[model samples]
Each structure stands twice: as structure tokens, then as C-alpha cells.
Target: MSDGPQRFAGHQSSHVDSDAAIRLTDTDAVTARYSAVQKGYIRDPFTRPLLPRGAQFQPSRPPLINVGTYVRSEGIDSLVTQWLELSQQEGKKCQIVSLGAGSDSRFWRIATGPHRNTVSAYIELDFSENTTKKAMAINKSRELKGTLGDPSNVKIVGGGTTLYSPVYHLIPADLRIPPHESLSQAFQLIDSAEGPILSPNLPTLILFECVLAYMSPAASDGVIKWFVDYFATSPEGTVLGGIVYEMFGLNDSFGKVMLNNLKARNVDLPGVEPYPTVASLPNRFLQLGFERAYAMTLRDIRRSCIGEVELERRANVNF
Candidate 1:
């Protein structure tokens, strides 16, 4: 009978506290982009504005980190390109949903690029803070102004509401906390297939860029199952698939380092232990009702896909 008011320090273990902390950790991806080119990571010409005005460099990443970035970005790029081309050929439109999209700059890059006409809509969802930062940047920047529409048309509201534009929509919603409940709530904000926003009948690419790893295994599975459910019930010829990029400790020295780094950031890899291998990656989705599933490690991808020449060139910037 000696308990008093709970201490604030003990609340650090709560989900709310962890979620906010991990958001800061997520910013590392943005900082890394500025040094990606110099570090031989990858080419990203549209990510600078998404970062802070006077952000510092973060070049002290695993050299092989470039391979991961390449695999994720190149893979998405290839998928998006093909999706766009096929849509153009079929004279249909498609949509892209970027989960935990933290000032990613993908919409602008894709919308203004050669395949600009292909993508009908691009939606980025994350916490309201991140969405607001991205929305504000898009509002203030000239590059992203006409990309969506007259800045006046862009709508920004508080939590649970979406910042809607003609092409790009920055939505603030929790991913998979509820059993299809939160997603259902978020759906109310989106236009239906018959409406003008994005065609629900068309193909969709849902990207989880190192986002799911932070979530518990059950929660991540909920996300996959939700998509499968949506595809199963949606109109015919509605293609749906996704890609997940994450680091599962390899049980090696590098794995230990990665684990320690993330732990230091107060971000726990809850799902990593469950699916630790490339083969295990796809099976996670296959079990969730996906027709096909495929995954490869960064090194395997570098050796087989990038080949000797490109890998050799990339090796110049040793980690």
C-alpha cells in the first residue's frame, strides 16, 4: 500500500511513447538520402526538400546499406515503371500507397518524370506530424506546387483526416492497430472507383519501406491480411501486391550492429526474429493469401542482379 502517482519514466515503455520515439528514428532514412549519392547508395534527386533545412550528414551507415537501398528503391522503381507502362497500354490508371511515408518525395519524382502520365494517384500515410511536414513542404516548394494542383486545393486537417490534393494525398492514419477498423475509417476519405480520385478497380502497389519491422508480428500480419481482403472483395481485374524492405538480424556481427543501432534509437524489431531469411520473407505474405511471394537478401541481390561490374563500382565506397 505504498504506491503513489506513477513516474513519467516508467511510461517510456508504452506504445505511445515508443511510437513517437520511432518516428524520430525514421528520420534517419531522410538524412541518409543526402549522402546516398556520395556514399554510392543510390540516385534520389527529389528527397532534399523533404529533409530539414539545415540537417547534418549521416554518412556513417553500413556500406552494404547502399545495397539495401538499391534493392528497395530499384525494385520499387522497376515495379512502378512497369505498372505505369501497362496501365498506359491498357489506358487505365493505378494508385500507389506508401506506408509510413516520411517525406519520401516519390510522388513528385514519379509525377514529374517521364512516366508522369502513368500514375493516377499517389497516397502517403503516416503520423500527422510527418504528413504535416510533407504537406507544408509541398505547399511552400515550387516544385511540388503544380505537381498536385493549385496549392489552394490541398486540404490539411488534424488527426484521422487526410490532406487531399488532386494527385497526391497525405493521409494520417494508424496502420493495422485495429482489425480493419482504422483502415475502414481511413477509406471514407478516399474516392470510390466510380469517382475521380483513384480507380479502385485498377492495380495498386502498397510499399512498406522498413516500416513493418517496427510493428509486432501480429500487427504486420494484419496489414497484409487487410490488403488481401480488399483485393478479394474489390472489382474483378483488381491487381494488388506489396513490397517490404527490412533488416532481419543475420545472426552475424553485422546483424548485431544493426540490432544495437536500432535498439539505441528505441525502435524494437518485433517482427525480425519471426522472418529472418529471404525465403521466409515471401512465405509470410503467401500464408496471408497472396498469390505469389518473392524475396532476396541484399548481398544475394547485389551479386546476382547488380552483377560483378556494378558491384565492383559500388565497392569503391567501402563501408
Candidate 2:
């Protein structure tokens, strides 16, 4: 979902002039969400307000894609809601850092939800171009801007590429670069009189939705390791959870077809080449010194993670 500097083996650059194509995936992701919202597959009041003026008129995606989007969104939502609830159980508020967050309404959704107070901070990082567009969209939408508390408290920085508020922050970052180099800009920003934007004492959750696939394994690992080390220096019991939604098992024929389909558009999945199976996906974090990690497919989540009644409800709702 992000197009940053990519480094691969035996090649200086495999994706020359492909940043635009990689960024186009963000448009596809947001459009898919909008389509699902329009089809009643999901309830997202914020997606529409943040979309481009004429994006809504585009035709809805196919039924299969809509259902897939529903499952993926619900699955991630379950994990995030559980993280917030867990923090509440511990009598603490948690923070969420969503990487490659392109036109995602998750921060707005969580800020307005029941567990809003359970979240101490919600930070979103992405390419500067995407962040600039999202910042403009947010500033242009009253409903979106109103959720950030007092208008006086919200200000756009980085020449309108970044927006800051009481509990929400949108910062531009290239995940391909070193975390210290790319992420220090965010670390330097002060959320309030609170000293630092990110609190090391609080539990944090790193959300990677359809990201990391475009970068090399080393780059992606560095990003996660940076967070791991950052929290390791914090107070004890500072939990860190990561949720990465991506496609794996690309060595098969079906995977080949999917890869070819994407390659036709000039996009590559270098990171995915390392984790080819569901079982191997956890190694992405486990090897980074995380205590535990797990991976599940959308189909698995739909079958066991969701209730039968909810499944029936979704099934009965046709496009």
C-alpha cells in the first residue's frame, strides 16, 4: 500500500519508476473500502467524507472483492478492539501506530467509538504525497475535522503534509528508509505539554495493513525491530502487538496468477517472497524477539473468528 525506496538482492533497483504504481494500490485499497461501505458490507461513515469528490461515483467492486474486504476489515477491527479492551482491563490506555495508512478512516472510527478513551494516541504514517492528500481531505470535511476536538487545537504542519490534534496525528514517513531517519520526525513532534508524541510507558500496537510486501525483508524487519527496541527501553510490562495483513504462499499456481496480475501493473512483492506460508508469517515478528506471534487467513477468520449470526447477517445482505 506504500511506495518507498526498495532494495532487493543482486539488483540495484527492480522497481524503477514504479513508485506511482505502488502508490496507486492505496487508491485501490480505499476504493475497495468505499465500495464495501456503499454495499452495506461495513459501516464506515468516515470513508465517504475523506474520499475524493468524484470517487464515490465509481462502480462498486465485484461481490468477491467486497466480501474479502469485509472479512479483512472485520478481522483487523476485532484484533484492534481487543487490544484496546485489553489495555482497559490493565487499567491503562494504549496507543496504536498504523503504518502505510492511506485514506484509512480507522483513527476517526476509533476516536468516535465507545473505546475512544481507552486510546491514548493514534498515529498514522505514510508517504508524504498520500498524507498531504489525506490532510487536505480531513481539513475539508467538517465531520472529520470536528472529531479532533477544538479547532484551535488542530493544526496542519509540514506544509500541510501533517496534521496534529489532541489524540490523533498524521505524519508522513517512508517505511523503506531507516526508522531512525524516517521516524525521528514523528518522535520529535510533541503531542502536547506531554513532552513526547509517543509514550514509551504505554502499551502500543503496530498496525500494518497490506504493507511491507513491497519492501525487502531486511527493510521490513528493520522497521519492526526499531519498534521492538524502542519499547524494550521502556518500563517493564510495556506490551507491543503487531498485526500485518498481507498475502503469502505465493509459490503456488494460484499465487502465481495473483503475482502475475499485480506484475502486469508494475508492482512487486519482495517482502512476501520471504514468508510464503501462514506458519512462516509469524517468524516475521518472532525472529524480531517478540514473545508471541500468530497468522490467520481471511477464510479462517471468517469461519471461526466470527459468530454464526453475524455471518448470516453478512450473507443475507446482498449487493
Candidate 3:
């Protein structure tokens, strides 16, 4: 789903904790997805399970938001599907690590979708509090816990903050912290008697959806570089792909207004300020040693990548 201004501001700014506002962004994301699902803009049965019980019933987001969510979800789904298919073509399964993953049901979707077998491992990392809540929700849901294979294999460790299955893992992590201290240690849990959860030989895809904008450029780059270095020594010539969905170009009038609004709520976008234009978005990866990278706004994707039927459907929904 798209992380628009409306979604970021979905929760009331009444919490005294600073990171509470940050964590609520996940609430905004899941609720927006629920809204889109209710409006016939998307199909996601798993999203409902991940949402808090209190937020299960809510009015639909505006038509524009529904459309944006549709486009954003479709676009990322397309890329992830392609990654999985590419791994299949190479006779290999891929690993996906979603940083700052909130109440996202992507792993469940991929595991049940056609590309289910193409994923060797699916890992999600988020703040400890969010992970604990998600872990509890998954623990309580039959549909969600069942997808992780045998209930016996599922272990809730880290004092119920981490859940691990054969193919899926939900771990608590704060991305703003140093990756070496945070990521490297957390990954150790994935190394089992079978092998490491993240094989250096396999193609890996790092997803940074609506996350990078919440951190400093240095911290965000460190996260990407950590992954880059992890696969750099692979003799198999492993390919590491990255996808970042964020807001940029806040110097413009509309952008300034959006920035000011977030600022008013104590949410600072230090990561976005570095990339003021779509043209500069690729630099986020390329400069960090990615062989290639591309940036496409929701507008361009809607105009070119989306089919006429979908556009017409969105138009009808809007009208």
C-alpha cells in the first residue's frame, strides 16, 4: 500500500512517546490496505488478520487514496513476482528481507500465491513493539499461523517478540540503529543446522517500502550497504535487488506543505530531503554499489505500466 500523507497521519498525535508516532505509521498502512480491500480496489484476506481488532471496522479511505493504494500495491507486487520468477528461471529460490516491515501480509500472500515455492525464505523486521503485537496477532489467528506450516515448527522466541517458521520469520529490529550491531546479530538466529536462512549464493531482494524516509540518509545507506557487502563475496555472482518506495522532492510548494504537516506531528523525513527529484532516487542505491537502479513515480507507473482497464476502473471508482 502507498504511504501517503493521509496514511502517515491516520493516528492521532496524542502519544507522549516519540517512537509511538513512528510505530503508528504501521497502523496507517494496514488500515489503508483494509480500506482498499473493502472498496474492491484490492484482494487481501490476510490483511484483516494482521489489523488490530479495534480497527477492523472503519470507513473507507477517500477514492483517491483507494486508487493510490491499488496502484502502489500492484506495482510492488509486479516487481516481487518478477523477482521470484527470475529465481525460478535460474533454478534457484530467492530470499526477501523486508526492512521496517509493519503489519504487512506480503509473505503470507507470496507463500499462498503462485510464487509460493519460489521463495526460499521470507523475513520481516520491525520495531520490537510492533513485532510483539504482530507476533501475538499471528499467534492468535489460525489462518495466519497455519500458513507457516506445522504449528509445532513455529517457535515464538525473544520473549514472544520473534516468530520463526521454516520459510517465514518475524523479528524485532530498529532500522535506525547500526546494521552491524542490529542486523548482524539478529541474522545469527536464522543460521541453523540446515544452513543459514540467507544463503550468499541465492539472489536476494531488499524491500524498503515507506521506510527509508523515516531515517537519516547515512543510516539508510548503511542498511543497504550492509546487504551489498553480505552478497559481495559470493562466488556464485549473486544478484541483490532493492526496492524503495518513499517520498522525495519536498522543496516544491505541495511537497513543502506535506513536509510541514509531518513536522507538525513530530515525524521528520531526513531520508527524503537528500533526494529532491525522482532522477536522484536511483542514486540511493547506485552510489552504494548497486549495478543499476530505477525510479518511477506513482504517476508515471499509472500512466504507462497500468493497463487501460485498471485505469478505467480507477476512474470509475473516482467518479
lDDT tens digits, residue span 99-175, model 1: 88886877887877877877767877787667767777776777676678776877776532357877788777777
Which model scores highest in lDDT? Answer: 2
Model 3 poorest 10 in a row by lDDT = 1-10
Tell me the tens digit of each residue's lDDT in model 2 across 1-319: 2335646778776566567778778888889899989888899999997776688999998888888888899999999998988988888989999999888999888989989899988999988778989999999899999999999999998778889888999998878888888876576676457667888888999999888898889989999999998888886758999989998988899899999999999989999888878999997688898999988888899987787788777766766
Count of backbone clashes, every candidate in sequence: 0, 0, 0
In model 1, the clashing pairs are none
- The digit string of per-residue lDDT tens for model 3 on 1-319 reads 1121222356776435667677887898899999888878888999998997789778779988888888999889888888998888888888999988989999999988888999988988888888889999999999999999999999999878899999999888767778887787777776589766677788899999999899888998898899999899899899999887888888989899988888887888888877889989997688899989999999887877799887788657533
Model 3 misplacement above 4 A = 1-16, 317-319
Question: Is 2 or 3 the stronger prediction by lDDT?
Answer: 2
lDDT of 2: 0.86
lDDT per model vs. reference: 0.71, 0.86, 0.85
- Show model 1 residue runs off by greater than 4 Å: 1-16, 38-41, 56-71, 159-161, 190-199, 314-319
The alpha-carbon lDDT assigned to residue 130 of candidate 1 equals: 71
